[model samples]
Target: MSEFLIVLLAGVASGALNAIGGGGTFVALPALVALGVPPVTANAVSRVALVPGSVASAWVYRREIKQVEGVATRDLTVVGVLGGSVGAGLLLALPASSFDAAVPWLIAFATVALACGPRLSRTLASSRGRAAVLSPRVLLAGQFLLGVYGGYFGGAVGILMMALWSVGTGLDAATGNPMRTAQVTAVYLSATVLFLTASNALSVPGHLTALLTGAVAGGFAGAHLGRRMPARLLQGVVLTTATAMTVLYFLRG
Candidate 1:
């Protein structure tokens, strides 16, 4: 029961983080690992379990979704799907030890990104002028790479996407968040398909069920709550959670 509750709470927190910013994997992945799942399998299972919540969050923002300035939404989605599939394949093909060793660094990078994202976005916005850079081709290429990363680990992928757009296009994070949610959903959607067919993600049915159920509930609730919460409060909550998770992972390593 204790383990079940811990997994459920992690799912809820992960769902909220994804909905609010983009650090869900930082919560979900480590939680599963703490419960004795192998790192690679945890990654696979996290991707699969979080899909419904991502989709739900995207659905909540559907009406707000719009084409980012200087970028083609349709083309980006295509590249996202393709890149996500490739990332998922690589995850299954790679040795388990490789992923285990990389876990600490991945979490560290993600935690720093989450912590610095807002300030970095602001700095880029101020100095870069409000003009969008990157031609359509370059933008598509960048999105593909980000999609690959999102599919592979997905810790701070949403924040990464927002950072890219903020630096390249001068688009504000608030304005681009809906699109971020959609693209993340796309990445997870493709990754989930691969995991379902090619991975052992479902071998632990109990953990999967608990996390998925909590994630879905959290997704719905977070979407509604996000609109009402102060932006600073949300950021503080996400940053605190991310910092603690990063420290824990480093210690475990």
Candidate 2:
């Protein structure tokens, strides 16, 4: 019962944060690790379980999805799928010890990105038409790399994607959010397929099912709530959670 509740709450928090912005992995991954799942397995399970939440959030913002200036949406999606598959394959192919050692640094990097990404995006966007000249190849390359990151660990990938789009296309954070949601869904969708087929997520059906159920519920509610919540407030909440998670994990390391 305790195990179920812990993951369920984590899933709710994770899905809600993801629906509003991103950082679902920060909650879901840590909670699963705390439950004695191996780091790699936890990462895989979290990604698979959160797929529905991301999909739900994407559906909520479907009407708002639009093309980024320089790159075609289909082109980016294809690259994202390919990169995500490679990342998932790498996660399975590598030794578990390597992932354990890298967890703290990965979380720390994601924490910094979560903290600075929005402001950085805005600043770059405000610069004298600089982002307007961003090349399609550069944008596509960045998206592919981010897709790999999303597949591997995916802490604040949505924030990073938004920053990428903001800098590459001079798009505002609010305006870019729907696309961020969609692309993240794309990355996780491909990653989930790989994780389910190759990873150990199936071994813990109890935990996986609990998290998925909570995420489905939370994702729906959060999408509706996000419209009314202030962006700063949402960012603050996610940052606080991400910071605490980063510190706790670092100390654990």
Model 1: residues with Cα > 4 Å off, grouped in runs: 96-130, 230-253
- Over the stretch 114-142, how does candidate 2's per-residue lDDT look in tens digits? 56655665576577555554588998998
lDDT of 1 by residue, 1-253 (tens): 8988999888898887788777788789989988999888899998898889988888898887878777778988999888888878887887655555665676566556555654665676677674555467877887898788777776667766766665566565566667888999999999999899989999988889889888888877777676566756765665565567667767877
Give me the displacement of residue 51 in model 2, in angstroms: 0.2
Alpha-carbon local distance difference test for all models: 0.78, 0.80
In model 1, the Cα lDDT at residue 159 comes to 69
TM-score of each: 0.84, 0.85
State how far residue 82 of model 1 sits from its true place (Å): 0.9
Could you tell me which residue pairs clash in candidate 1? none
Backbone clash total for model 1 is 0
Residue 120's lDDT within candidate 2 is: 69
- RMSD of candidates 1 onward, in order: 3.0, 2.8
